[model samples]
Target: MSAAADFAQDRDTLHFRGDLSLARLGSLPDQLDRFDGRVSRVDLSAVSRIDTVGAWVVHRFAARHNAQVEGLDEDSQMLFDHVVGAEQPVAQAPARPNGLIRFVAEVGAAAVQAGRTMYGLLGFLGATTIAFLNVIRHPSRFRFNATVQRFEVVGVSALGIVGLMSFLIGMVIAQQGAVQLAQFGAEVFTINLVGRLTFREMGVLMTAIMIAGRSGSAFAAQLGTMKLTEEIDAMRTIGVSPVEALVLPRVLAAVLMMPLLAFYSCMIALIGGGVLVWLDQGIPPATYIQRIREVVPITDLYIPLIKAPVFGAIIAVAGCFQGMLVESDAEQVGNRTTAAVVQAIFMVIVIDAFFAVFFTWVGWV
Candidate 1:
């Protein structure tokens, strides 16, 4: 038979009878709700069998009515005592402070993370420097094949996209500059604008951005995958330095190829601008060339060329460092790859700004 509780109320006293187990707890709440005024005490002598559920009901009733409980045997008394003790109030959560305090706390956390990232970057840079020196000391130890392969991957394979992007950018700059300069009757200065901007800033900047998005992310993904597979650890076990074998080749390729790529980007941009000016302003190719020669000095080319290898090194290091940071998970590989590209692009822009300020102060531009 299922357990049941019979509650008979008389003024300030209530009587509990029958089985007082879980199967009968359902009716107890309804019967208790029907009671009026105060229940001073509950008599439980008639409960033939009592379980934890029944003890809980008695405990709740006792708490609600300030009622004294009586007539429980040893097992029932133990359960009733335990349930009463277990019904202690839950501690309230502490209230949150105002928004300004939370904002400051968040800013502090961000600053801490930024500091860690910078420290890790410096450590990776030092490791790469030592690896380069070691390779220089023993040229035979260097991975020539890997360097060449990365050069082809990062340079040759990137040509078409880089060309198209730079070309379109140049055409847009020419068209926009010509339209604005026309009001001042200085439309021919579009050639000067395109030449200076393309060679000195936009060409290399856009190229680095592209390479960061393409090659930097690829580096992180490749290295992260190797890390996940324990291949880098395997290389270490075999007395191979991953810095030299894996990182050096990619870094070297970026350093060697970046200047060449920047030069190509500048040339294609200038050509695109020339073509646009010829069509829009009826300026001949020779006239545009003469204007470039007259207005855009060779010194302008030096800035971008000087910046290229540094930017490439930043991209490569960011990618490789982030890849090395990856943990043993597929999701972490993707996250690190995305982080590498974002960090590379951000570093490239920051470095470019610093270089611009330094060059302006030193009379380089």
Candidate 2:
């Protein structure tokens, strides 16, 4: 075998001429080190029989020393090409604003968008309500099977999440009550706190928020996707009322499910709260039950239960309306889905506030 190496200082280059092989790998690094970091480039055009190991050694040596290599013959060049092409440069995207000013701007834009969406939603609700009234007068246009399916989606599918959240909320309230009451030797009062809080506020509030985030968003996305695909337009072309076919079913489903979910949540929360009280405060179930009996009035339970279906109606109407009003494309579907959840939560809270004030004024609280 013949092996030769030469250096050309004027050009800042090193030349390798050899039958390059695995055994040659060890000395290659030393040859590169002899340049003492002076040479900026390597020319390997005269190299022959360059194997994979030789190529890897050359590539690694050049990379480590921050030198560029070129001028390989065909066989050596193929190996060099594989080594060079294997490395991909990372691409970094431009940075976005991260300060408070950017946050305020984004929030402001979102608020404006929300306001516009609310207006569109109100219009859709009005139109759907009117169409439903018309359907009531006619009665033959409603599809019973489709309506049942919608009910199942809105009610049955939502039960587990609603029940689980309510149960945990109950547990939290009970634990909190137990902690406060224990200090005063009134640990038995945990049941009253759990029952009153769960029935009057947490039950309805948690149920509405859950439905808004889960079912409402799902409704908006489903309808928005349908609208984007022009399925709504096709329904209209077939002489089917889009409002009757889409909006009414979801609204009815939500209205039907909300009360059931609210009741479930209230019971679960109460049970959870009771468990916490029993475990932490040493309050027996009978004493806990008795305290709830004395403190929680019937009106408190009724108030939240009533609010649940109403909140459900709002969620259904708002979600369906936003979905139907969606314009543009798939991006709009996502934006509207988010909007549906926010609006549903906001409406639930606002309505709950109204109920609170009204109930207090009427001596229900």
Candidate 3:
């Protein structure tokens, strides 16, 4: 039978009967309002069975009316006591601080997070340096095969896209600079502008940005996946230094490949600019070539070579650092990969700017 509640006005009692379980709770009184003032006692002698839900119902009714429960068997009373004992008030969260305090707190938290990220990147850089030193000390320990494989991926495979992008950028610079210089009857100077900019800054910067998007993100994703699957942890357990085996090869590969890539980029960009000038200004190829040779100094060529390896090292280190930071979450792979690209590009540009300032101070420009 379904459970029910009834008020016995004659005895000032609330009565429960039948199977008092969750399945039969619908048959109980819909409201306890009637028991508020009049009811002083509850009679549970006829309850055939009760569960936690049923016991809670009865307990609530009795508690509301300050009524005494009577005639429950030992089992029913125990169930009632257990259910009532388990009930607790839910705690509310504390209120947030108002206005400026909240804003300041958030800003402070962001600053702290940034500081931690900087500290972590610096630590990873140190570890990678130690790994590099170890490899240098024992050439036999160097992962030459792995480094060569990475070189193919980071350098050889990247040639087409980098070449295409550098070419387009060179054409744009030529078109814009030629149009402006034409006003001053100096349109021929486009060759000089293209040669110097491509070699000294644009070619290498573009290549670094591309490499950061490609190789850096790949490094982060690869390492982050290894981290997610506990492969990195397993390597540690087996006494394999992941930093030496994994990171050193990638960094070395970047260092080896970046200068070569940058040189290719500069050549392709200059070729693109030369083609554009010939087509647009009707300048002969021989004259353009001679002009570039005469106008662009050897120092411009050497500066990019110096910047390439440093930019490559920065990209590899930033990527690997973010990769090692991945927690056990799979979503973190994408996040860290994105972070790697952003960190590498940001650092690349900052370093490039600093180099510009230093070289300018030394009169290299």
Candidate 4:
């Protein structure tokens, strides 16, 4: 049978003997842990067949008591040195900060992030402007086919849904207006309300929101995927300007399509309102059309026409900007796509409000 490991203490020194392998040194570990007496040195001259586990135990004991180890063979000494070198500090949890302090810190971080995002967006806008100027100088660089394809995607394909939604919204507005006006015996004024509201605000605003959700998200996802697959990098290597090749076409399509789409939406909505007015109040379609022309101002039509292209540009730019910034994994593509839709819609609404105030100030109200 193999001899068991043993240790004896003489004053400030410890003398160990026999095999110092893992299983053989079982009780020696427990003894070292239980003993609390001073130990200045450990003598291992008689030790035989020492292994890594045994060396670890000896090293821990010497370290705990500030003791020196001696009489080890070259192999055993190397093993002990490896164990000592492999030590790591234990981690401790940090204390929580005060609630108010945490809240202020969060607000400060949010403000800083917003400032950085604004800065990046402005830089992207400048780059797009430069690309536009370059394309203007060299008209041959424009991608006619790509822009046409985007027109189909961003405008023609969206008509059915946009028309349906505007039709429903117009019906709702006329019905509600009739209900309120009936009490005052002013049900005929519902036509004026529908015409004015849809032409000036709802037509372009609703179309902008729809396009943002549809085309803006699509732009971000497409470009983000290209970025992930290094297609954008390939374009750069081939001396192709990504902004001119991809972004300009999409933005131009949106800008050209939005006014047409908004006008179509307004006309469809007016038709729906006319249908509602005839069914609910027994008014003739002829009278409804004449009344709309008489009550709705020309300025109302111009408002949506003016706003549509701006809203479209914002949507396209926001989407392409988020997409070009994408990096890392497939998950980032999805996140950037969502960010694009949200950013476009928010900017559209804010601009819409500003337009409202400006127009009101200029006597367009």
Each prediction's total of clashing residue pairs, residues at least 3 apart in sequence or on different chains, is 0, 1, 0, 0
TM-scores for every predicted model: 0.82, 0.69, 0.80, 0.84
Error of 4 at 93 (Å): 4.3
| Cα RMSD of predicted structure 4 | 3.7
Q: What are the runs in model 4 whose C-alpha is more than 4 Å off?
A: 1-7, 10-60, 66-93
From the highest TM-score down, the ranking of the candidates is 4, 1, 3, 2
lDDT of 1 by residue, 145-184 (tens): 9999999989999999999999999999999999999999
lDDT, candidate 1, at 52:
83
How high a TM-score does candidate 2 get?
0.69
Top TM-score: which candidate number? Answer: 4
Compose the digit string of candidate 3's lDDT tens values, residues 1-365: 45443334446877777777887667465656444557788888877778888788878888887888887788878878888889899999989889799999999998999899899989999999999898889888888899999999999999999999999999999999999999999998899899999998999999999999999999999999999999999999999899998999999999989999999999999989998999999999999989998989999999999999999999999999999889969899999999999999999999999999998998988
Candidate 3 error regions (>4 Å): 1-103
In candidate 4, position 237 carries an lDDT of: 100
Candidate 4 local Cα displacement, residue 37, angstroms: 5.6
lDDT of each: 0.92, 0.81, 0.89, 0.93
Model 1 poorest ten-residue lDDT run: 29-38
Quickly count the clashes in candidate 3. 0
